[model samples]
Target: MSMHQAGIIEKKDFDVKPYYNQLSSRTTHLKDIFEIYYRYEISKEEKFVMTPGFLNFQDIKKGTVLANSNGADVVADHASRLFMPLYQNQGNDGFFAVRKIPKSFLLVSAFCRKHRIDKLLPLLPGISWKSKDKDVLRVNKRVARVFAKQLFHLMGYRSKTWNKEYLEVRNREAAARYNEYQNEAWFRAAFE
Candidate 1:
């Protein structure tokens, strides 16, 4: 069988045995050689660029191109999901339409609404909290599980919990673009 068909290199080459031997000798134990090949191939391509971390919505734009290597499993998993749709043979004939309202406006509106909801969550009935020794509020897990985490994700915020008690959230948008979105009517209505 030819080395290209055996999945050694992305493109067909005249000789694969030498390249395969070099790659195999570099690793002490058996591993996924295809991933090594992918990294090497991507490095040679001028248009492809791989980020050391996860790609957020802010990193994607109309002409933005992204590549991924096997450095981080989380990054690879996310990149696979992000690029999987491109490999599928699907048609969007009637599934989508041009939006009359700008997407940024819609996203900002959702962000404002989520922020308002978060502020009011601690005051809702069935919600109870206590201040920990370090002045951190330990919210009721029942309410947090039902609302906070999922809501934050939907509004483009990354959420994490400390000891299942304190939830921390960070916006996923680019910091440089914060001022641009903050001036929107929806952002002002909820925040200002």
Candidate 2:
């Protein structure tokens, strides 16, 4: 089987990616691509450079000072695409580095998933489902190298390191809170 068919490829090669990238590319001066950056408060001496309502999607370099809150200098340790530069004083996320995901990726993924193509994922070596719902995925480092983080991110999965042995991926959309009472009359009446 081809590597591409086996979920081994670069972000651009992924058939199921997001559409934001495609649309943003066509528009001029539109900064829509982004990823999350959790804010870390290192010292009380540091001060923040951003303010609420500040424009987002600024490119940030590794080791560049981001803020000086509470008299301490806060610098970015890694270079990345910056999005949602935090302007608030009360949140944990400092900003998000977002990028556009092409719409075709979404379309293709939906089609494959609809046909149960994901059922084939576990058949590959070093891959398996962690939960009964089969939504949580675990993959070894070898497979992680073949399928980069962006590939799983495109598939609506958020990734986290698992015990230094595997990469654990969970679908963000599937992580939504279960509203079991949605179909109940009282729940419907409350909304109405």
C-alpha TM-scores of all predictions: 0.29, 0.56
lDDT of 1 by residue, 45-151 (tens): 22323443432112233333344334421133222212211222233211111113345555765766556444454477544334332122344556566675645
- What is the C-alpha local distance difference test score of candidate 2? 0.63
Return the top candidate by lDDT.
2
Q: Model 2, range 1-192, lDDT digits (tens) per residue?
A: 234433455447665434545645655575343345454543354455553343555656788676666666667777765666766666655555555556677666666644556667789998899888877889998898998786676566785766688899887656644376456553455334
Residue 72 in candidate 1 has what lDDT?
26
| Residue range with the least summed lDDT across 10 consecutive positions in model 1 | 32-41
TM-score of 1: 0.29
Q: What is the C-alpha lDDT of each candidate?
A: 0.40, 0.63
